[model samples]
Target: MTEEPRLSAQDMIDRLSPVLSLRTRIRAVAALLAGVTGAVFMGTLWWTEPGPLPGRTHLAFALLTVFCLAWAAYGGWLLTRRIPLFATDQVIAAWIGLVASLATTAVVTVVAVQRGAGVGLPSAAGGVFVAVALALVVRAQARRAALLRRKHELTGREER
Candidate 1:
């Protein structure tokens, strides 16, 4: 069996992003679409709330806004770059998905508890799917970064 040629860290990083596999391309597209949707929703929520903003509410609004903004920004960046957009960026995007999921679930749970209503299964499933897909992308990128770093350290030569 023949081993595949090693790729340099820079090369690997470059290769990690841009023009991905079809499945990954789908994930990236989904991330962007969800990011935009979440950001818009959160932005409107933050803007339209009535009454004075209290400390905790303000903080919550800030964090949620930042997270969702990051989600959208990362997605746009990825699309503009047309590359894999790196692992750290992917990690950020994944958190966006997970947060979107958790936040939606939490809201539904809180409302259901208050109103004695049932849960929304479809949204929960969609969120979970987005989270898992982006997460897989993050894991793959982190793994690739680590492997490239280790190989570079051992070989003392960065192969392209």
Candidate 2:
């Protein structure tokens, strides 16, 4: 009797987790980075200013920041939680998110200090970003380690 051929690690990974196309991955990463950066920059600059700003300026800043955050959230969802990205891609995305989150927090804190508004709206928003990004980073690392372990096990079995 002939034995059926076993699936390789790559094949198993394909079956277990469908891969996203390169273009999609790139777009997702870009959107996430740009959105986060824009939001942080706009929010920090707009919210920290002490003088009474015009209503239009407030509206513009608020609209722009919200739009950026929405895009960032969408891209983040695709790369980190919803879609099944490659282990390397996942790791990269997670790290990018962490860096962005750290930057956001830092900017917010600095602005708050400058404005003498300790732990205000900006701080709260930044805290949320850091917390979520930290969770995503931990999750991504765990998933990558798991994939590597599985690959090793499969390779060992194939050898046997």
Candidate 3:
């Protein structure tokens, strides 16, 4: 018997269909907008303030921004490969990004408080909001994927 082929990353992206269609483009756009807005807010706080931002705090914010951009960029890249793959990968990346942001925010908040920097509160809040938004976006994409799969199943049954 012939062995089943193992899928490479690019092959997987090529095989899966996107869960979100043109109707759901708004979700991707929202994710991008939220990511950019959070990045701008955190960047401003980190770079323009009078007192130096604590090293940990600066790094956390920077990582948060990078993850956001990565999520967006990955989603865009996946879209050209396969739509379903794009949705699946986007959800996975968003979840990882959220967790990383939350962990970083927690570490930075504790460090900033220890250093007597009260300004870290705003930063912490911003990080939390970004994490929450990312999580929500992932949930939305998952739901959309499920709906699409169901529709495809129904259509296939009718065709058969």
Off by over 4 Å in 3: 1-20, 78-82, 105-109, 112-160
Model 1 RMSD to the real structure? 8.3
Query: lDDT of each prediction vs. the true structure?
Result: 0.66, 0.74, 0.65
lDDT of 2 by residue, 74-136 (tens): 677666644444465566667777776776676667756866898678878988888988898
| Candidate ordering by lDDT (highest first) | 2, 1, 3
Question: Residue 54 deviation, candidate 2, in Å?
Answer: 20
Give candidate 3's error at residue 33 in angstroms: 1.6
Q: Model 1 — which ten-residue stretch has the worst lDDT? A: 81-90
Compared with the true structure, the alpha-carbon lDDT of candidate 1 equals: 0.66
Q: Model 2 lDDT vs. the true structure?
A: 0.74
* Clashing residue pairs found in predicted model 2: none
For candidate 1, write residues 50-115 as lDDT tens digits: 989866566566667766666667766666656433355556655665666666556556555556
Q: lDDT (0-100) at residue 2 of candidate 1? A: 100
- Which residue segments of model 1 deviate by more than 4 Å? 1-18, 82-142, 146-160
TM-score top scorer: 2
Cα lDDT of model 3 by residue, 49-148, tens digit: 7877667767677787776676566545544543344246556656666666666666667776777887568576867767686867678687767766
Error of 1 at 98 (Å): 9.5
At residue 123, what lDDT does model 1 achieve? 51
